[model samples]
Target: MTKRAGSAGRPTKPLLKAPVRIGSVDARAVVGELRQLHEDAEDPDVERMPADDELFGALLYVEKHAHALRRQTPEVQRAAALRRVQLWEYVREQVDVHQMHAVDDARQAGAQWIELAPVLAVNAPSAAYNKAKRLKAVELTDETPQARPLRRTPEAVLRAERRIASERAAERQAQEVAQLRHELLVPVVERLLEQRESFESDEDIDYWWEEIEAVLPHCQTPLQMVSLRRYLDAVLRALAKIEKRTARPVALSEEALLALAAARKVRQLDASR
Candidate 1:
């Protein structure tokens, strides 16, 4: 496929580089900004910044001066109350994220639900599992620091499980695709491009060359790079066929030959799958 005329580059900056103090005056705007961060990242499964350390520190400072805090104006008191609630919301989100991941890790490490139940402050194995699922559901649906309590219903848990599975699969695929590009596709493509003049006279390589050239610049992400795979595969096949059929095959540098060998192994794995 040809490159899109003006595709935007991948965002390099993280959603929240540092802990940000939420404004009590405009909760909705804060939520909107958070939502936009996720959108900007293309909804990748990645860890975000946890609760602000300073927020908790400030809370502790207030506690130490409790009598002085009580002497503050009603409006100031109301703002402090809002800030306290927002801090709790932030901490709650961090707790849910950590707890859900920790439970999964413990299970993967061969720990059972019965063992986890007491530690989770739940009555039974099923309760522990259900609680984790509920937390996962909350994580999947709600944006951070929600004004209202999270509605972690059973229905939401079911949906969250499905989303969790999808996100995991996408994450794995993106990683594998990136590995293939870096270790196999990129080096081989680089060698071929450097030897472009060698294939200029060959009619057989013209189509694949055009394809590779057009697609290379746009391979910025797994989603974009995925489409370039067919073209790469075609180039390998074309080159191999040319070597076999012609008495005078296009000469390859040692680097090109080695890169091609590594790339062929990846191709075999893909074909087997």
Candidate 2:
């Protein structure tokens, strides 16, 4: 094309501007389409699964949690939860590890199980029911401390009530840790702890005992610090204690969950009164 002379006497043609459009191919669509063409379809993938040893370690964690929760308190239970929160926060921010991996099974493997809440437990409805009953057992109506004429004295009753309250707190803390342990460890424990026997061996008992030992130091709740050695001696009784003798899993039944919730509500009311 020939240039045209401008009014200012400079040889010029109106610069034919490139069609100012925004698309993969200068189409009449939207601005975002061009960026979409360059964006990656998927992120770089790598091995996320824990190694064999790491998997076993995860199972150990599950076992530990289950053992602890059958008898802990709310405050202690809450601390266990904080541990999980810390792991994820640090991992996402790519932070270092110090008090890492509540179990630390995979410390050498260097494999991180980046899952959030992947463990599951199979406990009877009764376990939770028992937990609720212990926690929310307080009362306030006509059963005033001094008014109720019991074989036990007013001082004894007060002392008993205080003791029971402490015991209940321990129970709650245990329950919370139990929940955490089961969720993280159930699958792996099921996989690794597959010794086909009705009764656990003395070694098995020892392992279970060790788990209790590890978390008991962290057990600050009332009654939680008490040794379970006696129960462990009565192997069958210890099995019965957890309702772990059975393989079947039952959610807290409607009646059971309600009972626990009822106890909780009553306790809440009593505390206010």
Candidate 3:
């Protein structure tokens, strides 16, 4: 009889073995082993099974074992879930202990809650504060006794009233001074405009404006300064129109003329100083 293929010359390859049934095995232990195997497979130095048949066999083994665990009785599943809860609670308690230590150490180092907030990984300083408060991890100090209120004499009260009245009178006097300054400057600006209607060149006009600008800081109020600036802007626009040879002169409002006068007076005051 002819020898079976390859048996006579070379030993035949061994047949693939059936996966072992995982019946009645400790499901948690099996899962833990599977997890370890997965971690080992993920190692860069470890060589994985290259053949498709070998890979498939490994996959089927894990699938059948996992399916068996999933199909276990309801009581077994409940016990597994309870074990997981217990494990998680233990982890949480350890984390709480660590956090409490961290907070206490920070407090001992004289660090404020706001300063410690960023390092605690909380949403905000206030949240960190609340957490520290809940843990009773913050240090406290003794409160000072409250002092009794003092009673003022009638003469003292009268003196305070007089001081307040004086302050009001001073404010009104300052306002009047500012108003008088504004009124005096307006006419000076109008007179300057009447003197210089047109310029020979843009350079001359620019120089003229610069001279006026040098005195602007002498103006008492911001309103006077702002009005002066508006007047200058109008003057520049009018010059631009004149440069274009436009027949119409840029119109000026009564308020703008007053502003021009005020700016000119500010210039004179600045020169005198």
Top TM-score hit: 1
Tens digit per residue, CA lDDT, model 3, 1-273: 976785564332221222122223343444454444434435332234222234333334444443344555566545545544443444444455567688879889998878878877777878777665544311111122432111122333344446557878999997776576556655565555554533423554666565455545465566655566455555555465664785543225554445444554575564364
Q: lDDT of each structure?
A: 0.62, 0.35, 0.50
TM-score of each: 0.44, 0.16, 0.25
Q: Candidate 1, after superposition: displacement of residue 165 in Å?
A: 2.5
CA shift at 86, candidate 1, in angstroms?
2.2
Candidates sorted by TM-score, best first: 1, 3, 2
Give a tens-digit lDDT track for model 1, residues 1-273.
Answer: 988976865563342232243323343443333333433434432123222334444445443443444454566556555655776676666667788899889999999999999999999999988787776654454334542233565555676567668889999997886666455666667666666665413665778878888878767766656656778788777877777778554445565555566667766776666
Cα displacement (Å) at residue 265, model 2: 39
Poorest 10 consecutive residues of model 1 by lDDT?
Answer: 44-53
lDDT of 2: 0.35
Deviating ranges (above 4 Å) for candidate 2: 1-152, 187-273
